[model samples]
Target chain A: MGNDVSFFSNVLYMASNVQMIIAVLLGALGGVFVGFLPAFGSPTAVALLLPLTFLMPTDVSMVMLAGIYFGANFGGAIPAILVNTPGTPPAFITAIDGYPLAVKGKAKEALFVSNFSSFVGCILGAVMFYFLANVVGKAALAFGPAETFALMVLGLACVAGLSKGSIWRSIIALAFGVAITTIGIDPLTTVPRYTFGKIGLYSGIPFVPAMIGLFGISEAILLLQKGKMFEGDKVEEEKALNTKANGPTLLERAKMLPTNIISSIVGFVVGSIPGAGATVAGMMSWNLARQRSKTPEKFGKGAIEGVAASESANNAASAGALVPMLSLGIPGSSTTAVMLAALMMHDILPGPLLIVEQPGLISYLTASYIIGGLAAFIVFQLSIPLFEKLMYIAKPIIAGLVFVLAVSGTYFLRNSLTDIYIVALFGIIGYLMKHFDFPVAPTVLGLVLGGGLESNLRLALKIGGVGELFTPIASFCLLLALIMLVLPTIRSRRTRNEESQVM
Target chain B: MNRIVGLLIVIVSLAYTIGALKWSLWTEGNPGPGLFPVIIGIIALIAGVMCIVEGVIPVNGKQTLIQGLKWSAFLVALTVLVVFLMEFLGIAIGSGLAFAAVLTAGGYRRKFLLILIPIITTVSIYLVFGWWLHLPYVWIQ
Candidate 1:
């Protein structure tokens, strides 16, 4: 009780103080601005701001980063609502109902519902992480390489299953992603695998460059192909929605509480899985809410429930993603992976030890969620009009700017020309993948997990004989992975049979 | 389209398999470096074959063209231009020029805006990535 009181008091102090509050608000603002741009998700926002954090106190610095992470989800919903395009992967689900609502001149209402639901989700996720940290954190320590390998398999399978009819394409993309990481010198032995005798290939593929290329440059190329950014003649209709008074009343907003709560719960669970990330969590939440909705026909047709379901789930997922990283030293999502890297840079080893050693630090970081969520809501509400105007920035201008940023942002990471070429190659690949109806998420996630998966598999086999793979934990995870892979196919067959009967 | 993509993947993975076989596969009880690559190669091959099979499967639903893009050729050209320019003149100038070029390609003809937008963009990038972030390169100057 004493620790709880101190924790709450410190959080209050940090949030109430002028400077820390300003830092959080400013970080949230930057997050929103970055999140509004295509391919500039929370990872980029955090990566860009990581250097600045070194200058501040640990608590303030973490609070600022927390603000940015939470703020990004809110910011992503704006462009997704206003434009049919998603700024971040999680926002992809938001765009389904969001764009339609914007088409119906309910942009402000969607924005309001999203922000409000995000707050609720943020609160629930924070509470879960704080209370469950002691129990789940311990279980996480028992996971070995075999377990991790199985988990990665499950992650990839889930991605393929959720590809929305592009399962094979997603699988191919995932395979290519994993294969690409095999280049450069092999970690186990010094032998180079796929270098083709090039000196530049010795250091392995840079992660950030590939990411910026796959997401940023591909986005630019896609925008160029689309010919225009936003639909014209809808400008006047959009203007009507921009009116401050056009938002939903408090009572009407309260009605969506049920959907928001359900989606948030779903988001929290999905996010707890390593590598599952916000995209799946949010997607699952949105789908579940839609299924449970009384007026199913209203979904994907300017439904407020869609915005609530998506926003709540993704926001909650962010906090859930952190639980594993903070406690067990495993990254639940790529964004948290980046955060793990950042924490390591600060000489803080993130595992069970840190939780016991630095209880105050952990509390401060957790408290940032509550404070950051409120800050994000305030910042997003104030900046909605500015973001809408950003939507109108000339299509070519945005395309050009995105291309420039993608290239330069990638190059700056290592100052290597090889990085530039990788970005270019993957940028083209990404564009083609987009053109070919191949989901890009699988490819990126595969790349993120490639090194870790390979090394883990080898390490597990090295430590224990081949039989180690059959440990109860590893076997259970592998069984779950197998189910993930086959269950989708079975479901699709069942759906086909049911349709045939109906016909 | 499916067959073409599938064939491309198969060919690529086949080439990779040949390269990987140069390394020893199994060393003692633990697997060697080549083992992982072999597994990756097999996965690629399987996915490629699956792609081919899926292509042949008839569908009653809408089929969107995956690789059919009228602007693809132009987009490729723009990508090449940015990459090449980035090598010679540095990111700021290269990106400025590429920005103008892409704008023109996208059918934007506002002469002053094109010129002004690039300058502003380059300056902003230099300020953020160069001056503030201390990245190694942004402007040649």
Candidate 2:
């Protein structure tokens, strides 16, 4: 009670500052705009905008950047929902169900649900961060290399659930992705293992460009492959769009509030863990919602609950990622890592002492989530119709836009043409993978976690050999991974046996 | 086709695992760069063999690989060509050409749209990413 009162008091105090308010609004608006652009994720936007903040005061800049961080979560969902192209990797989960809704002419409902859930997620995650930041930060700091490695393994093992095809294919895809990550100079010994004498290979295949190719370019190719078949579906969708709005009512949307809150909590916890990003949070929450739902078959087939679960979790995870960064000087994701650098650039050190020394800054940052969420929501709501029109655009134009943006976004990453080649290569690979029914999500998750997994494994071995895996948290993660991998197979076998017996 | 893909995966994983052996598996009594890759390679190798076996097993119905390959190959060729052209024509012009080519390939028959939208898109992209944001590195020079 005392803490709540103090937190509310501080929030009220910061809310009164007009400059702070303006900064949050402006940053959030910019964030939404960039995020709405295909292929421009939050990390790129924040990295690009960081230079502009050098002229501003530390508190103002921090709040503004934080606002952008919060808002990008909302903006990334637009492309994912309207089209099947995810602006960020995590938004891919939103596209699973959200795009189907758009195809069903329920784009308005999809966007509304996404935006509303994001708003709820932000507020709830902020409240949780305020209450548990210190505790969560301390727990996160306790993670050693073994625990981190084990957690990553657990994350990778979720491929069992993520895969909708042959398990062997998913495993191969994941291993292939991990192999690709090993191309760079080894973190442990600085030895280039698979560079093949190319300068770009020394740094390994960049993940973002690879993502752009996998999702964006590959989608374009798939759409083009359909030709007349795709046009037929598009015509039906266009007709559906013109006919009537067939979606869940406002009350039905309201019924998902509990789901939003639950997913937000899940996202917040996952996000607080160092290096466990919004993608993992979104994946985990979507899987959990499927497990808990009465109509599990509706998942990935236009379930509104799927969109609600994923959007809320990803947004809340963005907010929750701040807990470790603000409290313990550890960043949980790439965007927060950049924000940490921004703080250090301003000579504002973040750690245990940060809360005591910079109460106003911390309070203002937490309060900005609500403001930023509201700003992003209003902007998105106002533009829902415009965003939905993207669905009606000619297929050729959409394909061209995806190609240009994918290529351009990859180029902007490091101003390297090598990345463009990487995108092209992955574009072909992704197309083949999709055609073969191999799940791409596992490959993505593996790529994202591969470097960390290796570094942590080597570090843990040095620290304690195999004994490191015996630690409580590490063992718990291994157990969880085992359960995640085994349970589905067992269930499927049981169902098959029962069917055979009935027949 | 599944058998071929599986065989390719097997060959690649074998090569990768062998390549990993060139690097030390352990250094200074700790695991080295080769360890992780070797583990991954082994997993992939096993999975590939299983995929191959599965592919060889006869199922209830005939499995057919669709004819989606030609269009995808065309798109891929265009992508490579556009990137190559960007070196000489600049990103704006290269992208304009790409837009026109892709639109035509995707069966857009309207002549005005094929001509006009590409120019508009090129100029708009340049203005936003090149002039205003100072992003998208190379423009003309």
Candidate 3:
């Protein structure tokens, strides 16, 4: 009863706060705009706008950042539908059906279904996030240092599935990320490990500048190679789906609801797993929906259900991606990793204790997410034609804007030019990694989690000797991590074998 | 290139482990700093070995390396230019040159855009970071 009263009181406080409302409104607006631009996915978008949050209170900052993340997920579908170019990986699937629908003069139907699906997905994701994060957080109260160490190991093990090239190389990348984070003065001992006596290396590396480099500057490098991204858009003249009453009424589309529900659940589940982001969730949900559809032939050919499936799953996945980050201090996606960085910067550490330590902040964040989603729906659904003009904006212009944001955001952190240099160095590293089909996400995750991982391991080891490694909970968690790493490779091999046999 | 990367990883990991050897492994019941590094270094070594083996036995076609080298080079040069600007000149020149250099690298050759946009970008950064956030980024000082 006391908890309920406090929770409602917090809600009432947030509801009356004008600044919080404004922050959400501004974040949603910025999210839609930045998300529509080229090479600015959710991570880059968050990293770019992160500086704005630096000046605001932590609650307001989180509200704005949450708004940006949610709005970006919805905004990416606009470009996917309009220009066959997805602003982010998750939206790429939306293009398969959405662009075709647009070409068939039913763009409005595709867009509407997509937004509706996204709304449903966001609602479902929020529900899952609230319940699951709370449950996970509570369960984690039973965890000791050994269990926490195992959890970090499990988090690192998930990097294998995220690798675009060789899993081995990704492991190397993860190790390298951990190694770099272990630089500067040791937390246990005052002795420096890899600082090599440079006073500049005192703080090791700032996650913000590293984030700007990995996501922001690397994006600029990728954009530099592609010439004229918007030039290929085949714009067509079509009437609005709203004006055309002959088409499926909102009620008729409501009949096609099973796929959307399934996709949302799938998305939420996939997104809850560390390292399995929205893109995979969208793709898997889309394929599953198609497999179950009566008119499988209609897929990839302007099917409204396809739009419903992918959009629902992707948006839910985006929301669900927050679960691991908030509950276990393990970021489920790149955007969440950056969000974790933002939280840490503001002296708010998210983990099992977050529920008890900062329940009011959590309540505000959860409310902001819902409010942000609604804002995205109203913004994107009501103003499709307005955002269509964004498709005509030149790629170079977007590149220029992002470039400015990158340098400014990096430099202003602690007012150090050294941050900019760090951005440059990591930018080059990110470029090479992307160029060679290596994954950058794992490294960032490793770096962010490395400090906690190190301390936890040391604590567990100190309390108990080498025997501590064999604790029941720790061993169980390690086995789960091993299974998570091995299962995907085994499945892939089996699929390959089946394909070869069929051939 | 893949072989070289794998070799580099192995070398780096080995060197790291060797350097960690100087630190005390364990003190009484407390685990020293070296223990964690040594364990991580071993994992790194295994990963490196795996990468090297994967590089040695390849079945698929190789993708081209040095993708769009010229553009990447120009972008790097532009970043360096900003570093020089910040050191020699001030924030105005640094940010303006950086923005201008980025535009040029992105194939923005329009005279007005090249000249005007950078100034706008620099000014916006100045007003926001310096004025609004109240950071100490002096434009001319």
**Which one wins on lDDT?**
2
C-alpha RMSD of candidate 2: 3.3
lDDT of 3 by residue, A1-503 (tens): 11333434554665577997788777877777667653355776677678888889877887778778887788778767865545555776787788778766676667778878888898778767766777644454566678777866775775565544456777777887788788878888877887788988977887657755765567666666554332233122223322332336868677767888899998887677665568657766766676577875577677778788888998888887787788778887778898899989988787877766766556556666777787677777667767544444455665566566666655654668788778877877777776666666667667766877888888888888668867898898699778867855675567668989999
Full candidate order by lDDT, most accurate first: 2, 1, 3
Report interface Cα RMSD per prediction: 3.8, 3.3, 3.3
Model 2 chain A lowest lDDT segment of ten: A1-10
**Error at A276, model 2, angstroms:** 1.1
User: Tens-digit lDDT track for model 1 on A1-503?
Assistant: 11333558767887678888988898888878777765466777777877877887766777787788888767878767875545566776787788778767677788888888888888888878777776656665567788777766765665544455645666778888888889889998888878879978887887667766776667666666555433454355446555554788878877889988888887886677666567767766765676577875576577789889888998888888887898888888767887899878767788877777777666667687788888888998898677656555666677777676666656665566666667767777777777666767677667767887898888888989688787897898678767766765675667779989999
Give the C-alpha miss distance for residue A167 in model 2, angstroms: 2.4
- For model 3 the TM-score comes to 0.69
Candidate 3: residue A234 lDDT (0-100): 17
Question: Number of the top candidate by DockQ?
Answer: 2
Residue by residue across A226-315, what tens digits does model 2's lDDT show? 654556767776787654574567789788988898899989988898888788888778878888899876787898888899888988
Better of 2 and 3 by DockQ: 2
DockQ of 3: 0.42
Predicted structure 1: lDDT: 0.74
Chain A: TM-score in each model? 0.80, 0.92, 0.62
In DockQ, how does model 2 score against the reference complex? 0.52
- The segments of candidate 1 whose C-alpha lies over 4 angstroms from its true place after superposition are A1-5, A51-59, A76-118, A228-314, A324-353, A497-503, B56-90
